[model samples]
Target: MLTEVKERLHSLGISVSSEPSNVDEVIIKFSIEKVTNHIKNQTNLSEIPTGLKEIAIDMVVGEYLFSKKSMGLLNIDSLDFGLIEKQVQDGDTNVTFAVEASSTPEAQFNAFIQYLRHDEVDFIRYRVLIW
Candidate 1:
């Protein structure tokens, strides 16, 4: 599964490192732009998308003037799934979440974080052809 994800990411222009022998503590590498573009590509967009993938990419970007955290740019980090698309063409993309204390809300946030931080996503494992 991990191998397929890496290969797909590669096909999308995201470079991935070999799987670490240690699953409990592993590092997965990827590019923000590549991941963002992959997500955008999975949905319908106005353009063919040859550049900065989305406007939302700016929000989560890590703040580092020198290092310059490019939010949309995917980097190797612990998998967090709660980060929602906030916007998607194919999907409604109409969901806004907030900081909640309830178990369900927390669960949702946890999932979002997991997805956002995920090293490998199953849906993005398909190969694409460019003509």
Candidate 2:
């Protein structure tokens, strides 16, 4: 999952670097200046795939960054648009996406995968197709 995110972000021209400098202590780091800038620039996260407006709200993104229990985002109930629910069970966080009726599945999935590719949601797995 992390690998896919890394690839996606990289392909999108977003810089994501990692460090596993030590053999005994392994710590992977995903650094992105654009993300910070996006937040600092006060860019609104829209619900549309690949659209700035689709990105989660700044506050929510910050909360996810602070939330340590993120498991994955989306599920069978995640097919819909407009309403994306967050759940944490047994210290695991999962994101359930509910796209609006107007949103296309591809657009939703693209936006979602991009978000999951971000440094915040570490582990992600989804089967239900949005498109």
Candidate 3:
């Protein structure tokens, strides 16, 4: 699972190199634990079901990315100030820098965090009622 997480991170453009420190490994492990716990708690199961292995992997990836973003370590190449249309002129020299919530980093981060938090719907099918 760690290897799969590392590969997923690499595929997402996040370089999890061993050099400098083993923090990346720690983060990956933490994410896995977190996702596993979430699954167990939500499903009332002692272990993750086989059907949810892929979902768990995805959640772990999301958690890892969330951690990286929180620590300011995630490099968002899509974030470009130049690409934002701050001003538009139509023979009037009108300059307006409108900041949309969907375009800001904070907004994006919040949206992602919300996604990771409320993604239990995916695990509903595998839930076990223990009453």
Candidate 4:
């Protein structure tokens, strides 16, 4: 799972180096566990289902980004999440980024949390209802 998350991060242009530092590994592991646990809890299952693996990977990536941002270690511009810019005018060098970028960190994290919750809807089919 760690490898998959790193690969996903790399694919997103986040630039996780070939040899990550101990701290980096810890952060990645933490993010994976956090996301996996959330999914497991949501579905009322002890393990993540194969069908939700991709979603879990994406969520882990988001969680990792959020952790880095909160620690002031990440530059939003460095990410290629497609949520960065709304428009860019090269002629006059006018650039407009998504509204969330201009907001407070808490607000941005809230928006991120909302996005993660949106993904949780996919777990509905796997949800276990125990009366």
RMSD of each: 14.4, 17.1, 6.9, 5.8
The residue ranges of model 2 lying beyond 4 angstroms of the native Cα positions read 21-131
Give the CA lDDT, 0 to 100, for residue 92 in model 4: 81
Q: What is the Cα-based TM-score of model 3?
A: 0.68
**Residue 15 of model 2: what lDDT?**
41
lDDT of 3 at 22: 80
Runs in model 1 deviating more than 4 A are 1-31, 37-108, 114-131
How many pairs of residues collide in each model?
22, 19, 0, 0
Off by over 4 Å in 4: 18-21, 80-118
Task: Give model 1's TM-score versus the native structure.
Answer: 0.21
Considering TM-score, which of the candidate structures 1 and 3 is the better prediction for this target? 3
Candidate 4: clashing pairs of residues: none
Task: Report how far off residue 85 is in candidate 1 (Å).
Answer: 21
Model 3's number of clashes is: 0
Tell me how candidate 3 scores on lDDT.
0.76
Model 1, 25: alpha-carbon shift in Å? Answer: 18
Query: Model 2, 125: alpha-carbon shift in Å?
Result: 15
Q: Which candidate number has the best TM-score?
A: 4
